[model samples]
Target: MASSKKSVFAAFTTMEIVLMAMLATANAVMTTYISPINQALNTLGGPIATSSITGIYMIYGLLAYYIIRKPGTAVITYGIGGVVQAFMGTAYGIASCFVAAACYMVIAELVFAIVRYRKWNLGVLMIAGGAMVPIWFFFAANMFHYTKWGTSILLIALGVRIVSGILLCGLLTQVLGSALIRTQLLRRFAISRGQGA
Candidate 1:
């Protein structure tokens, strides 16, 4: 009788850990620059800034998940990135980014778990990206409650964020992931090893 081969990458390798750390740290540094730009846009009457920044914030998880495809990768990457950003003293405060990253990953991880992590197509990406909206609102409402922003403005912001998440994080990630797959740079990962499915 022939025995089936156990998956070679059931556990993360050192290279994978290094890749995760590099990506997470890069994400944290990017946040330091992106957040101020977002605030500036908001001041200039650019309400869509929320959507843009959220999408940008979400890219790290999307990229990390795409490359790693391991369970809990999103949570770990986002958690580390968030902590790093908070410690770096982003304008939004450490607690805000920390909570935001935690919530975003929770929603994303739940969707991935339900799908058994099999589907990495556009539709699934869209769902995963869009799922962060509720968490965004939860955190935003808490932070902005003292600002006394009207319901109409809040609704507009939510709408913008949803659309942005779908486009920037969902569709864009799919496109970028496809590109990455084509470049053969991800050959070391399971997605290139025919084990992603």
Candidate 2:
């Protein structure tokens, strides 16, 4: 007999959507509130400029993916995060949100797919999050005039993004996720399901 267990889904369940929404919304609020601080950091120039706080934006999506362990979770979570951020109002406006959502989600999904979604370990998660930066930079270059910064500065920004991805999205997310698992709050989700908790 075939096992009842199945792989990731193309579509999410209602519960999954709700979970994603909550996480994404919280992330948006945090991100929006911190925008000014990050902008001020940008004035300082070099890697510190772009690397200041934006990495935290990746938190919700990374955590959602950890819990859901599903194919489209990253996209839906991050996309909703972008919508939430836009609705909450930001200096970058809605267009930036849409572009960011699209770019980050696409790259995140691709990286997750490449790993076959079998690995939820730190390094894999870091790679998935880091993968998003190139597309982020691509769109940001167009949307924010990164070209004016010169190649060296742009490269530094890229390094900052990758480092942030690993630290904020990967490491911090992993630590938080493990804590959530221990709380048994996620018992009904994929993470717990996998753990047989």
Candidate 3:
């Protein structure tokens, strides 16, 4: 058991850790910059508009996972992003940021685990990305009282979020990862070293 824990920890080298931290920081900043867009969407179409772009907010961790191809990549990336967002002052409040991060981490980790962390195809990545949505949506519904919005509206909002997850998060991650691989900049990472490219 101890050796197993050590191996998991050892899977993340110094470079991977640094890269994950950088990605997390970037995610925090980008999320902040996009708040105005989210607000505008909320104003125009309520939560559904905001939901449409939900995948954009979630890309950081997924991107990191795509590159790293490890068990705890999403957990570390999302965890650091949550901490950074909490420190940087998100519109969603510190607690909510952590809750959202935890939500993303749980499903991402679960999806990877189900595949035994071996698959890195577009379908699997999309499953991981799209899966990250609903749990958080459930929490958000209760937190923001979306249950009062009626079943149809709630279902619509959830559908939008799930599609956003599939397209914006999963599809975008694969696209970005491929681009990065082509640049040869990520040659040091698992993605470039393995089947990901």
Candidate 4:
């Protein structure tokens, strides 16, 4: 077998980096402002209404990773978002939340790594979504110690994450990616692999 070398990022530009950072910061702000909405959901106390925070993070993470197509983009995006929250001051003191966010961010990155940057199929997208996110389920289970949900139930929740992610994040990100391609920003690379110029 011949030895081969590979790169991780999908030829990201400086502008892309800054935009991803801005989106991450915006995610942090949303998390902070949505605190009340989460509380309200928790008060509802049902399977359909348990949590919302982590899902928001996943939405932004998907967008960042999709656009940047780098190994650690998700981590940086999620980390910076959490940092913004920390700056704003959180009930959990931001440090703990940041640590937790980092853990989940790594998970999201791993899913993308397994698929490689070029594979943007719905199945892969869904897998990434389920692997990393699932706000309304796991967090509630942990905080409330609700163990009534079985593995099958968990899988169902995971399925929802996957589907939702594909519909919202994956599709939207692909649109953005296509727009970038149309502008020729990605032509230097995308042209080689894609059919038309």
Best TM-score among the predictions, by candidate number: 3
Rank ordering of all candidates by lDDT, starting from the highest: 3, 2, 1, 4
Q: What TM-score would each prediction reach against the true structure? A: 0.87, 0.90, 0.93, 0.67
Better of 3 and 4 by lDDT: 3
Residue pairs clashing in model 1 are none
- Candidate 3 structure lDDT: 0.89
Which residue pairs does candidate 3 place in steric collision?
A: none
- lDDT (tens digit, per residue) of candidate 4 on 1-197: 12212454435667656766888777777767777776787578444353323345457777666655666777777777777778877755655567656756877777776665556555565567656655434664575455676766666555655555555555555565567667866544432245221
Taken over the whole model, the C-alpha lDDT of each candidate is: 0.75, 0.79, 0.89, 0.61
Report clash pairs, candidate 2.
none
Task: Give the Å shift of residue 110 in candidate 1.
Answer: 0.4
lDDT of 1 at 77: 81
What is the clash count for each candidate, in the order shown? 0, 0, 0, 0
lDDT of 4: 0.61
The runs of at least 3 residues in candidate 2 whose Cα sits more than 4 Å from the true structure, single-residue gaps closed, are: 1-5, 195-197
lDDT of 4 at 72: 76
Flag regions of model 3 displaced more than 4 Å: 1-10, 195-197
Candidate 1 runs further than 4 Å off = 1-9, 46-48, 194-197
